[model samples]
Target: MTISATIDGQLVQWRDSKRYLWLMGAIIPLIPMAMWGLYALTGSTLSWYFGPFFVYVLIPTFDLLAGLDPNNPPEELIEAIEEDRYYRWVTYAFLPLQLVGLIWGAYLLGGGTLPGIEDPLTVVQKIGLATGLGMVAGIGINTAHELGHKKEHMERWFARVALAQTFYGHFYIEHNRGHHVRVATPEDPASSRLGETLWEFLPRTVSGSFKSAWGLEKKRLNRLGKGPVTLKNDLFNAWSFSVVLWGGLMIAFGWEILPYLVIQAVLGIFLLESVNYLEHYGMKRQRLESGRYERVSPAHSWNSNNIGTNVLLYHLQRHSDHHANPTRRYQALRDFKEAPVLPTGYAGMMVLTWIPQVWRKVMDKKVLDHYDGDVSLANVHPRTAHKYGASLEGAAA
Candidate 1:
């Protein structure tokens, strides 16, 4: 669709080239169904691992081939594109498909046989299927993230529904109120420090974010003269959705599917945290003389314009703009030229995070360059501060 507006006595028109491509995100939840079809046709267990293969291998390859898309809508057309109902409907479509896929996957995990298969799946194959489900759960969090940032009540409710799959409802609270406030600082657990491996970051972020979310909710309840344990607490209310969803599935599918549910949920959490580890790795906001950190700017976050990941993740790669304008619709997110650039799209970068040495080799230099070769200006890991000539005093200042 071409968005046209008359601004300051001049006619301006902008057509979003990737308008239809955004629909690809909604198709992600259908990967499990596609995997089942492939297995039915080929009778190969390898088809169960299709989710990880698609995300890690195929998406990265597509990113390399598709390259960057640096185009931003003209300034006057930003409001027109953001208000388009078509774009939001595409995101809303994902929730129903995601729920259906989870139910179907649970049935299969519980030994239910379908038209094509006469025999039940093996344990190994079941684990592969669980891993595939994990991919959907992980990406669903990204979908939730987009919806959660909006001011609409319906969209916020949809965000909680998306998070129910991973039982990560706390993220809706912490990300919006906690992380955004403390991002790129020592206090934010979601912000990864220099020399901190993905192995190190995963546990810290998972545990810390949970604690932070709980604290934030508790404080809000205290103001209302309520206790944190009540349903009125955002943490408890958000988590209630997961309890109903998972508990209902267990009743329908039997207790045997419990282990696989745990597996998928863990992997889903890991996948989301991996993205957090890379988004602001080594970036820091300097403290001022008044003992306050500077306001977040485009320089604080890493960004990419890779068309493949951009289409798949709803322009989430434009992290700088997201931080700058939290409520801006994904279609209206503009890339800032001043932001630090990633070597490739998020999918490719996530693979690098798995190998600590390789990740440091590829990214440490980029961090140093971003800070003009000053280690003190970066968020260096406390254990590795000396290695980077960064003192604790300098970091705190």
Candidate 2:
């Protein structure tokens, strides 16, 4: 579908026009963390569940904003997605609050093994904290994820600090330099191989992500010929600092804290991988005779139009365009017609993903038979648009 370029005497993209959306994208994570802080005073069960759900299901969804495209958006009710996205940039305002929540949570929890395991109150507290810590991770880890890919260096630094919360220090290197370049292809270790279930996708994504991050650092070091020390090597520094800080924090707080911290890391990464799973699913690229892949297009990634997911995550559901133009920012990424479309948005799919058999059945055929393009570089690609209810695919070209 072609779009009208001229509006108000300017070629404004609908996605770019909605810069205000970005403001919502930026700081929503703090809402739950703040609630968790208030809950800290009460230690109520409702607070525990609400905190984890908001962090895991809520904040990460803010990422959808990063994938908005102005060419096609959710009808005229929302105009100028790009302008709306400019607002999302404001999310950094809550960064300090997120930090406070994490430190406070760490203070309340941390340490090797908990003593007095027989105490009911302590057991409940431990479980609650386990989930709450994951929520804490959602704040730091996911928040950094949104900023890490930006062209701005200060934004990238903010992302690094967020990664430090989960002790996943190498995300800046692995994600920007590694994942973006290799996504939707076998070259990207983060992309799930054919027939690989999400269960299997988990280990490969986590381990591969860390390894890639380290390798990124090594490549830089080799150019400079410096050891894996010095502040320049952020990953190494983060790893060392994380181990010491987490351990020291645990010792200082009490044994109850360590399990929760580790759990948070696992949960946050798991959420990250889940997004990875949805981003590529069955999409792939074309390999040219030169032994390099063809230029990326929006058709190379999967798209989901589910309004709930789109509204929540800031349009990250439109992933294909983001990968095609990594620096375009969420505002400029177009919601192209070539990408494959998902039946549901992220929230529903996230629920479906939990049941492997169902998720496989639901997604496999849609990916296999529906869309087609130059996939020798990697396999299936689909398109999704929020404005249309229809799910369409282009048979292999």
Candidate 3:
């Protein structure tokens, strides 16, 4: 069924199919619920691990089989799509479910009265459950990323609330203030360098991001003549909330729950870093003689038009457009023909990164090709410059 309406002096037809596309993101939350249901029915540990298995295994296979989505909405319909509240509501409605799944996973692993796992969860089961649930919580970060860019106050606050679930509240500050400004440069910890494996990138990103968040907050306070210790620091406010929430969970559940929360939060942060690593790996904005990098363009990021993951991640695969226009709504983000394209959706790419040799083999040539074999244009890792014959002396710092 299709509904037609007039807007901006143009006739807009909304088909039922197009109307419900945002519901695709609900798959992230549903995976955990399905895993728990299966575990309850069969009393199998395999069921508890099924969520991550489905995400990393089956989803990528299906995406490969389904192929890409080359279609884009007509230019006239973009305004209507951006204005549609259905897409935003789909994200908001899932926020509470993310928390519920986190709590559910905690209860099961923390030796609560959950029926699905009667025996005390083993160390391996706890880790497996935490990792599985962490991926689900990553959806909250994705939603937060979308909402944090909005101009509305409530949406921004809700984004922080979602971030607190994974104890990743500082992402709200660092990403917008630090990452966006320094993206595709050596100054941005979130942007992965060429030949940097996940192992090397994770430590730098995890530690550098928190430090960057603090520095960004301090700079903001200094500009306003407010001290660093004041409440005006959004990082302080957000992380304080996370600390209190984690403390409260410990009290409500048990000491055992502390490790569960910590482990899951680590996984959630890793999930974020993994996406960050892929978004601009080995891509750099050119530095003009004026001593400033050129404006970020579509060519600075990797884009994937894989239909399955695009819907699953709320069009994050069209990253080139998102970075180029930070305020553009997800539904309105466009794919650029000039942007470097990923060979597959993020899911498959993430799995490949687990084997560093495979990841380097596949991505190194692509990165070199993007710069037309000029290694200097790529963001070469400082230690690995010898491998690429790239000089960092004139590179944008």
Which has the greatest TM-score?
A: 1
Residue 376 displacement (Å), model 2: 7.7
Worst 10 residues of 3 by lDDT: 13-22
Runs in model 1 deviating more than 4 A are: none
The parts of candidate 2 lying over 4 Å away from their true place are 1-47, 52-89, 110-121, 229-231, 240-252, 371-397
Candidate 1, residue 87: lDDT: 95
TM-score of 1: 0.98
Q: TM-scores of all models?
A: 0.98, 0.75, 0.93
Q: CA lDDT of 265 in candidate 2? A: 78
lDDT of 3 by residue, 222-335 (tens): 999988898888887898868876776677677777777887778777778899999999999888999999999999999998877877788898998889888888877888
Ranked by lDDT, top first = 1, 3, 2
Cα RMSD to the true fold for all candidates: 1.1, 8.1, 2.2
lDDT of each: 0.92, 0.61, 0.82
- In model 2, how large is the Cα lDDT of residue 181? 83
Candidate 3, residue 380: the lDDT equals 84
